[model samples]
Target: MVLPAPRYRKPANDLRPALPPAQRSGYTSALASPGPFTEMEKLLAVTAIGPDRAGLVRDLSEVVTRSGCSIHESRMMALGSEFAMLMLVGGNWHAIGKLRERAAELQEATGLTITLRDASARPKVDAVPYLVDVVTLDHEGIVLGLSEFFASRGLEIAEMSTRRYNAPHTGAIMFSVQMTVNVPASVHMASLREEFFAYCDAENLDAVLEPAQR
Candidate 1:
C-alpha cells in the first residue's frame, strides 16, 4: 500500500530571540530590522588666540557650522590687542572628525593659534558649592597662596575670575578674586569656615565665604 503524502509544516521563525512580555512587542521592528544606530555625542574643548579684528567670531562660527558641530558654551574676550576664546563644542563622532580635518584650514584662515582637546563628561560628585571672594592690595603670590590653601584641603575650584583696579576714592590699586569651590559633604562646614577665615586674616585678605546662590 502507498503511504499517504507527508504534510508540509511551516518553518519556525528563529531569527529573533525569545523576549519577555515587556520586550516582545517591539522585538521585530525595533531590534530585528536594520536601522541606523545612534553614535554617542562627544565634546571638544577648543581654545584660540590671535590678534583682535573684525568678524573673527563670525569666521570661527562659520567653520564650526560647516563641520556640523555646535558650540555649547564659550567665553570670548580681548586682552590688550589680542583676542582669546574658549569654547565647549558638541557633536557626534563623525562631526568631530570633520572638525579635526578642517582644523588646519580654520587656523590658516582665522590667523589664530588653535588647540583642540578631548573633553569627556566628568562623573557626578556629591558636594556643596560655595562662593569665595577675596580682595586686597595688589601683590604677588595672592592666587598661588589661595590655590594652595584650597588644594591642601582637597577642594575643587569650579570657576574663578580675578581682576585689578584702583580703589574708588583712595586710588590705591587693589586685586579681587571670585571663585566657586566644591566642598565635600564630609567636611565640617563650621570648621572649614573658621579655617578659611583664619587663613584670609593671616594673608591680609578681606574675604567672604558663603554658599553659592543656586
Candidate 2:
C-alpha cells in the first residue's frame, strides 16, 4: 500500500534523541551556550496538515517566528476539507534547536499534524527535461502505473500533480496529470516516447510526451 509519510522524520545522519522534559526545561547556561549559529546554517523542512480553519497561517507563522527561524520558502493550500502546508525554515544551530524543542507544543496547541526533517542541501540534477500529460477515465492505480512505468526506465520525476474532474461535454469523470520528468542524457528520447506510448496503450491511457519548454 502506498501511504503518506508521517510527520517529524529524523534523517539517518541525526543521531541525537529528543531531549527529556527535564533537560528541555533547563537551558544549558546562556553564557556557555553558543547562540544562533551565524556562520553555520541549515534548513529544516516542515510539513503540516489539519482540518481547514481560520488563523491556520497565522498560527504556523507564529511558531516559526517564535523559534527564531526564517521562512525560506513555503506553500499552503486547501485539499478538500484538509489544509496542507510545506515550508522550509533556515536558522543557526541554536535556533533550530529551539524549533525542534518547541514544535510539538505548536502541534498540540493547534491540533495540526506536523513533521520535520533536515534538508541539508539540494544536489544539482543534470538531465534532459520532458513534459508528460495524461488523461483518462478516473480509476485507481493510474498514478501507481505511471510511476512504475517511469521507474522501470530509470527516469526521475521532478514534479507531478493529478486531479479528477468531469469531462467538458460528456460530464464523464476523468483523471488528468501533468508532470515533468528528467531523462538522463544517456537515454534516447525517441525510444523513450515509444515506450511511454506502449505502456499507455496497454493501460487505456491517453498521453503525450514532449520536450519541456525552457
Candidate 3:
C-alpha cells in the first residue's frame, strides 16, 4: 500500500471498529499471501490502551518480546489519564493465532483494552497537501477533542507524533503534536485556518496549519 506522505494527515477512516473476540472477524494476516511459505512472516497491527502510570511501557514491550514478534514501528501517547499504544509487529504468518491469543492475555493482565488487525489490509491512506502542528498542555479530553475538531471539519489526520516536554527535575506535562493531513481539493484552506485558530483559541491551545512543501 502506498502510504500518503506527511502532506495528507488524516485519521484512518477505514480502520475496522474494535469488537469482542466472539464478534471479531477472525485471524487473517493482511500482510501475507496464500503462497506456501518456507518461513513464517506476517505484519500485524496491535493496539493497546490503559490508565497512565509507571511501568506500563515496560509491560507492553515485554509482551511483544515474549510473543516472538519483532517490532517494526510504534506510536503511542498518554491521552489525559489513559495511555494508547499502536505497534507494527512482524512474525511468522502461522503464529498469528498464538499472537492474537497472547495479545488478549496481555490485555487482561494489563487491565487495558487491546485489539489486533492486519496492518497490510489497513484502510487506504488519502493524500493531501498540508501539515498540521499542535502544541498543548497535557490534560484530559485532548485527543478526543482534537479528533472531534478535525472530523467536524472533514479533515483526516494521517500521521501524528506527540510527547511530553519537561526538564529532569521539573517533570512538566506540556505536549507537542505534529500531524500530516489529507486536504481535499474542495476545502478552503484560508477559512479552515481561521476556524482552526478560533477553535484553538477557545481551548487555549496553540496550533499552526500550513501547506506542505513538496
Q: Give the winner by TM-score.
A: 1
Runs of candidate 3 exceeding 4 Å displacement = 1-41, 121-129, 134-155, 160-178, 184-207, 211-214
Whole-model lDDT values for every prediction: 0.71, 0.71, 0.63
Candidate 3, 44-128: lDDT as tens digits: 8888898998987688777777777777667667899999988877777656667787778878877988889885524433334
TM-score quality measure for candidate 1: 0.78
Count of steric clashes across candidates, in order = 0, 3, 12
lDDT for predicted candidate 3 compared with the true structure: 0.63
| TM-score: the better of candidates 1 and 2 | 1
**What's the best-to-worst order under TM-score?**
1, 2, 3
Query: How far out, in Å, is residue 102 in model 3?
Result: 2.2
- Extract clashing residue pairs from model 2: 7-115, 8-115, 8-116
Report model 3's TM-score to 2 decimal places. 0.49
Q: Once model 3 is optimally superposed onto the true structure by TM-score, how far is the C-alpha of residue 128 displaced, in angstroms?
A: 4.9
Worst ten-residue run, lDDT, model 3? 23-32
Model 2 alpha-carbon drift over 4 Å, by segment: 1-39
